[model samples]
Target: MPLSSPVPRALRHTRAIEVEAFARDDGLWDLDARITDVKVRDVTLASGVRTGGTYLHNLHLRITINRELTIVDAEAASDAVPYPGYCDTIAPAYKKLIGLSLMKGFRLGVKERLSGVLGCTHLSELAQILPTAAIQAYANDVIQTRDGAGHDPLPDKPFQIDKCHALRAEGPAVAVYYPRWVAKAVPG
Candidate 1:
């Protein structure tokens, strides 16, 4: 199971931290209040661990962060669950949201959307989609990169937010593997 943070429960300050952090980058914001709930999915091929084309096994990272990070009103965001059939079906359609060259743009768009809402002082809370901007931006970038770059592999630069609300921005922080092929054999 993924582990929740040591930050205890949500409070005004904690919520603020959560809001500010998530309000910047959707991926770093684990709105679910518990990191443990965040799962990274992988794609595998031919029963091999290291060989084959891979998709980020965890397609639900965006969804989970969106669902969990909406702390302004837990009740309102409670219903934001992963699509029932998403995992089973996403593989065929899965594509990287951010490629190597455009990661800065991809992340910047996320921050723009998140921060954009904060300008609304009258609104004490931010919406789920506000954080989703990152995901959407990445998706858009991925489509363009794939089409324009001719199948060049892009590096995944995953990031995370901490209790202090500081962002740990660095190289591909999270590694998710997707197997291009799978075996019918079930483990006994």
Candidate 2:
């Protein structure tokens, strides 16, 4: 979305991040995330002044996991980058996420495993997409579990109002899985 202003303007910088989730035929999941940073107008960066439309960052990441949401494989690549040498070398560190689960505290685990010299900050950010993507990839199972066709989806933890307000203990969404927590409240 472009910001609106009374002042005249020209395209400057555009940073786009896209994350996609895929359900594999064998009951696994695949996540692909790409980040593209473009200079829409001449701008000076640490490297040098870049021409408009030049890509400052073209990074790609892929993660594969099982139904349990435990990472099975992970890979990252930098096709275009603002810096050299260091950024391209972090590919090896992403493997450390292979057994990590797509669950609460997953982001902190990713940061701990890949922060500083071990990982590129951007790639580390991409690791956070796994938990949400797992929801998309397993929507059927989630709904079935909530409907009592499978195990309880919420586990022992009560509905959280802070994490996702729609699923709050005070909202109607609780009726779907934790009917005991349902009450009157704005869904959003």
Candidate 3:
């Protein structure tokens, strides 16, 4: 974890609607920002990765501003990240196992969509839309779902963003998350 810094007490509060307003008023409805510090967490059952019958992977992408973007450092909260269910352990060697091409595609697509939707011409414009909640919601659909039947995993639904944060500084930080599925069956 980085140094424990505190987030600003308050700034302009903007919900999805207000964010939309900012984007529209600023003519920045097609901007996507880069996602950094991306970490992948795997949720396994007691049966283990190959025998568990189901595995869930959550990709959390964290980024800090490198340009004229505002960043509000919020006190890191333990409960902020929610898990639908308990996870046995975070997998190791996931990157080597998942491959780079797929990772690049996923990250690139996310950045493109974000930049396109926000239309952030400058880093500041992108900063306003930082601290974006609902990123998890958006990821729900990006993750692949595996059924342990040797069939390919596919997206089950549309992605939605669950959380958003905004910081006004020369550079701002943001995080986006998505889920992926892995599964296998053990012979009883």
Candidate 4:
């Protein structure tokens, strides 16, 4: 359902985030995330004055992970920033993400390694989307979500079964779409 119309309001600032996932030929996956911030009105910053429609911040973050969802390579770039030299210098710090697992404690690990002055706020925020993005990219290709009829030998439950409201183990949606897993999900 779409949201109800709201009171008329003027546009001021806009922030756009885009994430793309790619399956590499070497049997790995790459998730690239970018963030852009633009102001509809002129803004003054310590670096200089940013004209309307110009980018105040443009950042990119990419992480390459193996089938196990463990990050093997990570990189970040700051193309446009409010504070040029200082803000761009922190891009290299994102390499700390290597070796972290997207399915396990990834958010907390990001905070511990890149919070506060350790990393740029925009780029760090972009990293948070990678986990879910990777999961969506690997839905059927890498991880068998069992969305279709199959008697595959994988024994573990579907990764998304209890992850959200609609896919809750005991929810009606599950009863109709994933009936086989329903019995195993209910309390004994």
Candidate 5:
């Protein structure tokens, strides 16, 4: 369903975040993400004046992970920014993500290593989405998360069974699509 029409409003600013996943020939996966912020009207900043339709901030981040979802390499770049020298210098700090697993406490690990002064606010925020983006990218292609099958020793439930409202083990969607994981009624 689409959102209903609302009172007329003028455009002010736009922020776009894009994430793309690619499978490397070497059996790894690359998740590339970019964030761009644009203002509809000219804005003055501490640095200088940014003209209308120009990018206020444009940043890029990429992480390479193996089938296990462990990041083997990470990098970030700031093509356009409010503070050029300062903002772009923080790109190297993202390397600390190399050893982290996207599926295991990735957000917390990112916070511990790159929060506040240690990292760029925008890049850090962009890193937060990689985990789910990777999952969505690898859904059935690199990893089989759907039917609860294909593993040497299958888990009691699929990884996505209770992760969302539509997939809740006790929900109707689960009863129809993932019947094997439907929650059993408790004996009263």
Candidate 6:
């Protein structure tokens, strides 16, 4: 077992979310997200129940997507939770994520599919982070293959030349990757 960190005080509880990227032999990437809510000291629930060193919410979510970031598979499990029955209530609906692509409008899609009464709040929150992590995990190979080099694990796609100050068409990256869109020098 690894050595534990120093103990904390006044820390009634902790909410830890961990996301891990994994490579599979079948050419798909797997992203695992785990959420844990732990209380350091004994606490009383609103129902007059007392518990300590217990998990308020322990959720594990797995998402498998291909190079194009289309969801190939998804599964979720609740090992423990403050209310176990409520935990599984919204899990089944996450399967709707299949065939959905992770792109610019993906966040809204997540909201539509797994928000409010449609899905588990904690699980939905964790699933929201998978798209970015999946892009980082799966796109490195694609970028390297197509560009002949990995450019920060992502290729320049959309900037519209005026999205932000640093990303202006005159920015260094745009000047190199999208020279045609670069802002021309002004004559004094």
lDDT string, candidate 4, 17-81, tens digits: 99999999999988999999999999999788999999998999999999999999999999999
Clashing pairs in 5: none
Displacement of the residue 12 alpha carbon in candidate 6, Å = 2.5
lDDT of predicted model 1: 0.27
Ordered list by lDDT, greatest first: 5, 4, 2, 6, 1, 3
lDDT (tens digit, per residue) of candidate 2 on 36-79: 89987777768778778988888998998887778899888998
State residue 164's C-alpha deviation in candidate 4, in Å. Answer: 0.6
Alpha-carbon runs more than 4 Å astray in model 6: 1-9, 46-50, 145-188
List model 5 lDDT by residue over 1-188, tens digit each.
Answer: 99999899999999999999999999999999999999999999999999999999899999999999999999999999998788889999999999999988999999999999999999999999999999999987976676533434335566778888889888988887667778987888
Write down the worst ten-residue block by lDDT for model 2.
142-151
Q: lDDT by residue for model 6 over 1-188, one digit each (tens)? A: 98888777476778999988888899888889999988887777753443677787889898888877888888888887666566666666888788788765777888998898888888888988887677566543643312212333225544234656765866886676655556787998
Expressed as tens digits, the lDDT of each residue in 1-188 for candidate 3 is 79787787643222121121112243222122321111233334364432121213222222221112222111111111123332212212111112122212434432543344232222222333333422322233323323223555444421222222331111122121122321223577
Q: How many residue pairs clash in model 6? A: 0
| Tens digit per residue, CA lDDT, model 1, 32-69 | 22111222333232443322222222222222233232
Better of 4 and 6 by TM-score: 4
Task: List candidate 5 stretches off by more than 4 Å.
Answer: 148-156
lDDT of the structure predicted as candidate 5:
0.90
Clashing pairs in 6: none
| Clash totals in order | 20, 0, 41, 0, 0, 0
lDDT of each: 0.27, 0.75, 0.26, 0.90, 0.90, 0.74
User: Cα lDDT for residue 45, model 2?
Assistant: 69
Candidate ordering by TM-score (highest first): 5, 4, 2, 6, 1, 3
Clash count (model 1, backbone only): 20
Q: How many backbone clashes can be found in candidate 3?
A: 41
Stretches off by above 4 angstroms in model 3 are: 1-55, 70-188
Ranking 2 against 3 by TM-score, winner: 2
